[model samples]
Target: MSKKVTGNAFDAKIFKRLMGFAARYKWQFIVSTISAILMSIVSVAKPILLQKIVMIYFENKDKEGLLNYSLLMILFLLAEVILQFLFIYIVNWMGQHIIKDIRIQLQKHMLQFKMSYFDNSSVGKLVTRLVSDTETIAQFFGQGLFMIISDLLKMFVVAIVMLWMNWKLAFIAFIILPILIYATKLFQIAIKSAFQEVRIQVANLNGFVQERVTGMNIVQLFNREKIEYENFIKINNKHKKAHVRTVWYYSIFFPIAEILSSIAVGLLVWYGSLDIVNEGITDAGQIIAFIMMSQMLFRPLRQIADKFNTLQMGMVAGDRVFEVLDTHSQIDKTGKVEAKDFKGNIAFKNVHFSYIEGEEVLKGISFNVNAGETVAIVGATGAGKSTIINLINRFYEINEGEICVDNQNIKQYTLKSLRKKIAVVLQDVFLFSDSIFNNIILSNETITLDEVKNAAKEIGIHEFIMSLPNNYHYNVKERGAMLSSGQRQLIAFLRAYVSKPSILILDEATSSIDSYSEKLIQQATDKITRHQTSIIIAHRLTTVKKADKIIVMDKGRIVEQGSHLELLHKNGYYKNLYDMQFASEVA
Candidate 1:
């Protein structure tokens, strides 16, 4: 999923919020500012003292003043070293703290987003957004903040010293300033383009690898090892090309900046030498001092040039992360109004829904399930059996009409209050990479070990868990790859039933369990569904035979609905469904 890049290009205004992100640890930034300023002051003093030592001490033989100036220069050098260290440390502290907050906030925001957000979003893109992209942005502010502040300080101090010591020489050097600025600006553009290319390629590479790693089982099952290997190489080649382009740009700019700085120094020395020869005024030390100062000025000019590339990459990544954080989910519970209790009465009134434009998946569907009744939705593949369950639970908002629970419109109730009473087990079960106990708990409050064991026993997987070396402590790998399909489904069943919801939706929940486990779960289901509103979407007709009401759906519409024996007598859609699964019907 390639997100359209909308990086706020080198905008000074965007950085205002960037500053706000750092405000949480602004004291560290203050310390960094002080350290950087002090360092700049000490650095600029040395060349002035050198010129004085040459003109007064060496030429006029003033021993006392020379020694004092030399001692002061040494002291300034020491101060510069200590302050530079402090500056680096403080800015780093500030940068790292801001990164931590941004990452945590990004995850929290991701959690609050609607389910559709994940449906359209890619896991690999999000991983890159959270990990590599966050790191790059953090480093940009960390190192880039120091470079900006420290260099601006050095430039200011250098300009002042240049004017005070020898205004004429300073004027000669400043003549080339416009040309250098133009060159750096153009070079920064080149590097920015290069960095953007690198960022895009890196994001693509991450996505490719993440998808492949996630679908490893599918790859092995189909015997597509060579195809997978080729896919990896294709992305690797793209990354290499991008990296080479970045390095190529860097190589050119570094040398060009160096040559320009040297030419400016050479011109200043050429002009300053003529004045010294004509008046016999300037000494060797002043020329050396001039060279040192020129180099000092260009050093940070070069750093800003290099760091601009990093800044560009960071901006690209920061924009991606902010997109997720800035989005407001379609479902929000901010109204402060809520349904106090859900008695399991679900009412759908003229509900119309569609997953795509110009095509209705559920059309003007109206139905009512009274409290504590068992409702089974039966349908062909394209029929809206799952869609109806989805609408009742308010997973997908209705396009037209309203759904009510316990006599109140669902939209008026807090989403938490609306969903707290519902538990759904989809055909595909997802388990986290945690212990079996935690997976059973499934983001709800932790349950007692006894409750976990009992839920497992109800699903008929308890004795099997104890048979393993870790039992309840057994580690379930990603999606429960370490366990069998039957084991995974049984565990997912416990996760749903243990919540004790007022309403239960089992969409082919027992599809994977063995005959023995199915028998056990059927027994437990009878007691659990006694007074709870149950909606079961069955593939095996016999599993839902005892449901109080059965509704048959076709082509996004309900074709027929009645009690099991009543539907069978009608010999309609449900009758054909029963005939199709005859073996399971009589099992």
Candidate 2:
């Protein structure tokens, strides 16, 4: 990926967060910095020590001086090796620990975001952000931080050694140094953008592949394999182009940087030898030191180039990571409101709501249900039936007015505490890939097997579990794909029962099941709702016939609401709906 991203994606705050998190490990970081300083000085000391050995010990033919110098150099190198190890180990450990904290915070923040955010984002992209992108950010802390420190220290040490050798030649060599640094930085920005494009294309490709593969059966049934393949090819080509662009940038960068450094080193050598011959004041020691100075300066200059390259990568990955970190989730529980008791009495007061603006789904909705009441919501598809229950559950905030639980406005309660009191078994049942017993009990490490069996039995799924080869210990496949739709729904019902909630909500809970399973569900519903406040949203008119209060809604408004017998007597919308279904069954 290119090192430089567009100015649009650049976020100073994200950079601050990244650096600040690493800064938390102050002691380890301080130690690493000290080690770099010591190492840089010791490194330069090697050449200085060599110079002294040659001039004083070797020239004078003093064997004792040579032996002492050799022993001291060995000791210095050993200490340097140990310090190098400590620097690497401390930095690595701190970076990983900081990353763990960041990941946890990112997860918590993402979970709080509104469901609408997810509707527009692909699950594959989100997964990549959480798992891969976060790791990239952590890597900047571990590798990038240490490299920058070592490079800068080496550069400073080289400058000092160069000044001590021949100040005039040293000054001339570094004249183009600022320009080289600036050019690399500019190239780094370009590289960052290239990498960002690559990441985006790759992320989109992943999303396309994941969704297409998961629904491969549908694609094959429709005979659209060729069409899907073409779509895949388009994204794949885009990714390839992005990678190629990055390569091209580096091709230009490395060569230009190499030429500049080479030219500087060539000048240093030519002038140093000329000055030695012409002035007669420059000695062999001076020439050797000048050569050493040339190497020291050029070496780190090359490394600084590579450091900027790594920085570009961090910028690209950081942009993607910050995108997720910046998102605001839906569940806002910042209010300090606490709800101690909800008596299962839910009321919607002048509630006005809409999934989209100026297209209200529940307009001026008003209703009240006392504790232990069974109220059924009957409406045609898109008649705002599900919206009613969603409002009561506080899944979506109403545009205007209040929804109260036990006369306390839901907004007045903390989201965590309020949601815990309600249980819902939706039509789209989702089961984890776990044993049947765990699926039912869900959190029964302490709860007994009898409780799991009792809940399953309540939903008439106990016998089925016992019949399984390993019973509750049997592992389920993804999405409970191994189980029948009815079986999955029954497990969902048992899961809700395990919560022991005051309010029970079933939004078309039995829509996909066979007749026998429907009867089993109906039987379970009857017993479960014996004394609980229940809300059933369904299209089957017969299911709500025995309800004490049956509400009929249409076009975002409740047209008629009364007992089933009362609506039938009036021969209104509900009566017509029931009669039409009854006539179709009879035919």
Candidate 3:
């Protein structure tokens, strides 16, 4: 299903939620609002002062009276300037604070999202919400909202003043109000749809760019750079088109506003001349003041429309952000039991599971591992080997099974405590862009540098680490790209070793390791698995040779279970797997 780009116009629920963040600094916003109100009043007073000087003081031939009024006008101008600066600083400060709070809250909420949500969602789209959308919302608080309120108030005050000065001239000046209002309404509706399109295109462009950059190596390796570049240009053009539509609406609206404004001025001159010819109804100063007042009234009417667009854009962003915040897809962490001293006697009873419904991966499978025993699961690809590891770690909940550790249901233990008792080393290891030491210890205050070094030395990887520049402090770059595959595997092994968990999981850890590294890994594995419950999923089969028990699986069911030598004698699935590997190696 395609997603809608725009939210409800003037969504009170979203507006109230956004205001909740601004309310943290209510005193500052209140002070800025009061300043805006005063500025509007001061702005309206200037036209009156201009009228008094022209008619009452300038025409009287009194230089002293003119000088006094001029001084008062200067004071008002200076006061307006000071208040503008004050409000500008305060409003911007409050905006920054509110967005800072919002970004932090959004990040915290994202951290709680389920793994499944991330599995299907785009990282680039989420980034747009965190960075661009939140920034747009910031403009609403800093500039759009306050300017809109000030403009509306100025128009109101100017309207009253114009009527008081000369009701007939005000009537002639406001004759174009109906047309102006209709044009503005149409502009608002058109611009809103355009802004929504712009936002949607921006998100799509960001997603494309982020994914392409991250995987540029693969694109170049496959020699598909030209095709990818063409795809990017297509997306870029769509984004450009969305923005151009917005400009098109702006072009139409502003010219109409200017024409109406000029007509109002022309009407004032044309009608005021009749008043002068009919009788001495209005003076020159009042006529001039009426012109200035018309500008004050009509210009803000246009500005109010523009500022309302800013507000609408902010609401669109707020709707997107709040949708993520309101999602309730987090895993249930209600288990109260704490596995303080986990013995790791693992068992899976009648486990049936699937990544998708009605397509079972581990169907009616049962297995058991005694404390301190090592078990190896061997199978062809997609034969539920890795799925077993995932279920044991509870990365996904089983459809119909009870997985237990230490003779109690695994779900009975608190997730934090349960995971702390186990460590996993996958063949495709991932490391953060940090120092090797930090990657191994992972900021666990309890594991010091010395302990990490001791673990590395015991695992026989200390010499390899020391060979790098800066030794243990060497940066591994992103995803450990600086290291060889074997070196990264060794690092993963050492990382798991430092945790000192009761259960160790090695999912094809030696599949990509070189022969020399494999020897060291085998030695480390033998030592580590001696007194812990270990589960090894292997395709090479050689790595599982020394395992106390081997469970052979095919199509999500265990077909054979025995020692390495006994499995070879059975002349079954394990024997066929062994013979196939031996024949390929001999050839």
Q: Lowest lDDT 10-mer window, candidate 2? A: 1-10
Residue 216 Cα positional deviation in candidate 2, in Å, after optimal superposition: 0.9
What tens digits encode model 3's per-residue C-alpha lDDT throughout 187-302? 88788789778978987997888888989999999998999999999999999999999999999999999999999999998888778777767777777888889998889887
TM-scores vs. true structure, each candidate = 0.90, 0.88, 0.89
**lDDT tens per residue, model 1, 496-556:** 7888888888888777777876776677678688888998988766656788998788888
Ranking, lDDT, top scorer first: 3, 1, 2
Q: lDDT for model 1, on a 0 to 1 scale?
A: 0.79
Residue 417 in candidate 2, Cα distance off native in Å: 2.7
lDDT of each: 0.79, 0.77, 0.86
Instruction: Kindly report which residue pairs in candidate 3 clash with one another.
Output: none
